[model samples]
Target: MFSSTIQVSVFVFVTALIGFLTYLSCRGQNRSSQNQNREYFLAGGGLAWYFVAGSITLTNLSTDQLVGMNGNQMALLALWEFSAVVGLFVLAKVFLPVYYKFKCTTTTELLEQRYHDKHIRAVISALFFLGSALIFCPAVIYSGSLFMQSMFGVDLPLMYIAVTFVVVGALYAIFGGLRAVAVSDTYSGVLLLTMAVLVVILALQAIDYNFDGIPVERLTLIGDNDSPIPWHTLLTGMIFIQMFYWGTNQVITQRAMAAPSLKEAQKGVFAAAGIRLLIVPAIIVIPGIVSYKLFGDIGDSAYGKIVATVLPDWLSGVFAAAMAAAVLTTFNSNLNSATALYVCDIHESYVNKTPNVPKLSGYVTVLLCLVSLALIPVYQQADSIINLIQQLYGLLSMPILSVFIVGLLFRNVHANAAIGSVLFGVALYSAMSFEFSPMYAPFGLHYIHLMFVTLIACVSFALISNKVIFNQKAEFSLALYKEEEAK
Candidate 1:
């Protein structure tokens, strides 16, 4: 009983310390800028490279990656992290220049500029908002709550813990805006990364660095046909998946875009890529594999259980604090970005153009928080949260990527044609995923491969629809290509 008290004390101390440090870092920023949107949402373009790197890293790192990837208990899951390195590079090299050139406030703003249509921007932003509110927000809360419950062996109801996260995270997004979210992410990231590495080392030690009893498939990086990630799919859909996520996803890209210059943002992204390649992969997968040896097929509980088993009472509290901070930082990051999408993309375009930035964001943040909390029960039934998120994200990801591809690669394409192609891609991927069609079944194609196919179809549909249905000739352009080469 005394041990539990010590653990709780350490957790509170560490969590509060990180918060105080974040407060110190973000204090005295000019909140009353002429462009209030830029000041509030983009941090007035003042974030240095280190904060940009830290925010990008921790915003993506969260308990979802820790709990969900480890839940699989295999080395193959490391491929996700490996591929993400390539994704980050793509963000830095390919996407950042265009974003800088356009001076985009949101990623979808680039689409509006390219296609000359505000409606398409609103449509895509609505999809991003829905994807965040429906999938990411609830999934992060559910997985984080589960990790806490398993780590502390707490008997409290999951919903009770979830509500706590939602409230605290909402406060961060509401009060500090992106500046506080990014600062807190960087601070939490250092603690989380250090403790996660310790957990990995200790986890391996607990098992005496043995893998004799684990199956070959579990230890192998090359996934077979029936595995969750088939080897062939890596060649087909994996690169594009990384491109879409790191290049275009508003939540991740917003950090890079907030930097004062494109070069600074690219530097931050490259640093994040280095971390993904080196540190993230091992920490995410190794502990879970070790847990299988110790606990035997525990699923998502493997990570928290392993941490509790390996660490003593007080250290477990520190790790718990790191994890809870991870949950809050990630939650608020998404809340901030989702509110950015609504305020910049939806509400500003549709409602009052000069609505109060903080006031309107406060209302949207609360609405999103309520919706995310209400959806926690839906994610509770998932067998693997990470895999489930990847699969479900196909409903939006490829279709959205296709729009960017069309907008960036070609000229004279009608905005409605791109929108039509998005709807088509969604329907096609949904039918294939839900087994409404047996077209892919004969070849035993994985859903990842299906995503690639969906992307190609969407791009083709957009181009063809432009010429035939909309009676506008879509011309392939090397203008941006030449401009990028000159740079």
Candidate 2:
């Protein structure tokens, strides 16, 4: 116990010190250095392709990848890992062009411009931001912390870690803005990927290069349909979920918006996709299969135990540090994005009318910190963080994607179509998840299934009503900012 305590303390201290140094390095340019609001959020329209790639990779490759996806793949599904590759293709080829042309801060801004309706923009933004904060962000933090607590045998209060996470994350953003987040993300991304590679190698070496001596069939994406998750359902559900996550999730898309050019941004997306394609099988799915092989009767809470028993002492400490970094990086990005949505989209547009840049930035940070702090207990007691994150995104994604796709592809989807689509999507998705069950009528679909249903429903609704909903063609002649023009 004493050795474990010393090890964790050393790891925490080193992490804090490195993060503080990163914060200092990024502190040079004040908020005034940003010439416009776009630069403030998008990193001065000059983020190199590498930083864009690193930030997006770090943002998407979080505790969910390590804990939830990895856990599921090891146990019941291998098709899930392949979704990362497929999703990357969609992001690189399908999603980037529209966002590049529109040049939006929040995804909902595209909706407002296309539909010419403030109500649609407000609803989409609110749902996206809330789902990210209340569900995805907190769940990832909780999953990572759960691993830490189990690994170190430290009964560290969830409240303490939650407060610390929010405060430090807010500091990174409020002071340095998006640039700070991007810079720190570069550091975190390297640390995370390196350690993940190490974990894979060490796990393989420990298992005598045979991957837990499992038979060939288990490694392949084929098995009986009677399994808890059939291969057919896994493929369909994961493809849609991955599309919604990579293409539309603000934390990931915001990194692309921070890129210097459309080309560089697309490169970043490609690089991120490449990394996911390589790491998913190595990091998450294999670990799960190995866990079951090494530890008998492994359950959802057994991931850390598997790692601790399998890895050497020094390596275990390193793995824990890497997991913590993943959690911290994910939490920080979400808090930063959520604050931006509130201050830029909601506050300045509605409440403040004219916001003081620095002061508003600080206020947004504090507001998010307090809200996250308040939710610590809720997160601690939550039974299923991964499930919650998926369900929240499932409920909220329909409208956001509906408007985004309409604006990008159709260019004539009416504002009312966007609004009606969101209303219908959210209500229907929620009802399907909560009200329908197998006993009642074999609602046998999961949350990921519902996300696709919502996506289709919203798209069909938008298309059907386009003619009547969009009575007049909206103007699209707003001049690009000087910085965007320079690009």
Candidate 3:
């Protein structure tokens, strides 16, 4: 082990560099009312292509994927990243053009415009907020701190570390808004992804360029239905999960919405797809499997323990900064989106029509940080971070994806009919997942395949509801989705 002085010096240097970059990017943005809604919530609608790409990649790249996927301990987990490419392509080619045309502040705004109803917007927005406050934000903090504690061997209490992350991550969200969150994400994303690649290389070296000791199932592409990622589920549910996440989820799509122009945003989305194809697959899988070789079935501790084992003593500090960056990016990104949903969908709609948005956002950010922080202990009980995430969202993701699918595909489906699908979806998926509470997973299908069942049921019921209950109105026309211009 290195001297405490050396560790302190390296850690301080790395964090200071991160601070400098953040200040540099957000220096000129101030808290003016006209600019508040624009700059704070949407980065003044002026984010460039590179920043857009970096923010998008980093927002999703944190411990949720890194620690959680690695915790699964298999190369098959790489398919999650691989499937995301198709999702990004859809976002760029299918969704980006329409979003830019409407100038939406959040993903739900597009839902409202598409259906010509604010209620539809509010429902989806509420789902986004609930998902963030209850599940996404807390899980990020929990999983990230778990990794940090394992890697650094911090002597502090786990709750103390969780609260510390909240304070730091909250500052990034409350002080800067989307501009601050997006810029910091891009700046730190570079260092974080680079260091992750280095870990992959070092992990291979630690194993002496061999995979013989690792289990065959861990290295294989095909997973049984009982595996965390079943191969059959990939053909059915994986694509939709990626689409809902990358294309429609407010936390991620918020970054895409903040771009300067449609062309630039498309470039960013495309660029992120390219990065996922190569870099992300390694970043998520190799280190965990390598840790299997070195440490033997450590579960979630694999990532932190592997990083600690493989990197040089001095580089550990830099890696710490990178991990902190990843943690903060995902945490702050959710906080910003949570604030946006409240202000745009709830507060402005009900509290005050012309409220001081900056002040309101600040208030919302603090409240959300506290709520999310309080939920950290809940996540602490999870068996597998990634599996917990999928299980939690299983109740919402497919159903939400159905809303977009029905709204975008069927022109005659009115706003009221759309709401029925969303409500049904939420209720239906919850019942199916929680059937184990009072029942069992209706006929033994895996949750992933069950997602397909849920989607089809939502769509079919929506169509029937539109025809019988609401009397299909041509309220939203198919022609609204124009061919987005080529870059």
Candidate 4:
């Protein structure tokens, strides 16, 4: 490790550049005075392919994935990033067009249009907001701060680092909006990928370019039944997981939603897919693998530890800046999306139809960041940040995804039926995942398998209740949905 002066100087210089570039990137966006909500929330619906690609990748790439996946210290974790390509493809081909057809400001708004039920839209948007506040926002800050502390060996209090992350993220979301976040994220995304590749190279060289010393199981992509990612789960649940996250999640999908045209948006997602295939696996898993070789089973600290151990001092500061940018990318994305949900779903719909959207959005962003800061301690107690995320996702993903599935697949599933399906899916998944006595992971099935059970069960419930309970007339027509979209 180099002297403290070098680390301090490099960190300051790199971070200053991050600020200057962010300001420069968002300057054009600030001057646009039209449709405040569209300009601020959705970047005036003007993102091109490259911005879409960069923003999506960075928003998803933070130390949460790096630390959390590497925390498992297994190559099997590459499945998470690799499988995301499928999710992006599905988003582009299947989901993105529908979103464009409807011209939704928020992803959950599509549910309202689909079912002609504002209540369901509110419920889903609330769920997205809750997930962001409780799970995503906190996890990103905590993990990024953890990585920073490990890399710099800083003596500062954890909350100080947490506050800095929260403030920077809030500024981007509050003032700069989606345009600002996307621009900064794109630049950081490129730098992060480049620096991460360097880490892999240096790590390999550190180990004398030999693989024999690394544990075979750590290097193997095939995960055993007990492994963090079982091989079978990839087939059973991974695809749906990817779709729910990339295709439907507000934080990630909002970037693609901001594109000015369907073609531009689609190209952005395609670029992300290419990056995922080539750059992500190398950066996300290789460092952790090298960490495992150097220091046995350090878990979540593996990424930070490996970066600190392998890179030169100047490079460490540079990577730290990239890491900060990654953390902020996720944070800013979540904040922007959360604010969008509130303004569109709750504030405009319920509180004030004529409210100043930009003003309200900024206020909401600040409040949410504080709440997220308060929740960081909850994540600090967790044994593994990624596992906690997956477990929590168990409660939300399949059930939420089912709502989209029913709406898109069956023209005749009534609003009440869709409601029942979503509610039942949530309840059943909760019971099985939390192991509430007799309802536990039915027949000793894995949670992912239980997701399949819950999705099928929910669909059945919706269809059954529509036919039997409500005796609702079944009508099959794309025209009904298109009518809403055209509005």
Window of ten residues with lowest summed lDDT in model 1: 478-487
Give lDDT: candidate 3, residue 73: 79
* Each prediction's TM-score versus the true structure: 0.98, 0.87, 0.96, 0.95
TM-score of candidate 3 to 2 decimals: 0.96
Clashing pairs in 1: none
Q: Candidate 1: list runs displaced more than 4 Å.
A: 436-442, 484-487
- After best superposition, candidate 4 residue 334: deviation in angstroms? 0.3
Clashing pairs in 3: 39-44
Model 4 TM-score on a 0 to 1 scale: 0.95
Model 2 lDDT at residue 313: 76
The true-versus-predicted C-alpha distance at residue 341 of model 4, in Å, is 0.8
Off by over 4 Å in 4: 30-34, 473-487
How well is each residue in 1-487 modelled by candidate 4, as lDDT tens digits?
3466777777778777877897886775544555666787888887889999999999999989988988887788898888999999999988888898888888888888888888888888888999998899999999999999888898998889999999988988887889889989998888888998999899889888777777777888887877777788888888998999999999988999899888889999999999999989888888888888889888898888888888887677788888998999899999999998988888888888767777888888888888988998899999989989988977788888888887876665577787777888888888888855578777777777778787778878887888998887556555533443321
Better of 2 and 4 by TM-score: 4
lDDT of 2 by residue, 1-487 (tens): 7667767776777577658766775665544543546656767666778888888888777776677655553444445556767776787666666577677786667667766777777777787778766776667666776677777766778666666666666777766667777777877788778877766676667677776467555576664554444566565556777776778777778888888788888888788777767765577666666665676435455567667777677566666766776777777788777766776678867887667665777776676667666665676664545555666666776656766766666655577776787787777777777655432212566556566777888878767765556564433332322224313
Report the C-alpha lDDT of model 3 over 22-63, residue by residue, as the tens digit: 889889765566656667788888889898899999999998
Candidate 3 Cα outliers beyond 4 Å, as residue runs? 30-32, 435-439, 473-478, 483-487
Each candidate's lDDT (Cα)? 0.91, 0.68, 0.84, 0.85
* Candidates by lDDT, descending order: 1, 4, 3, 2
Q: RMSD for each model, in Å, please?
A: 1.4, 4.1, 1.9, 2.3
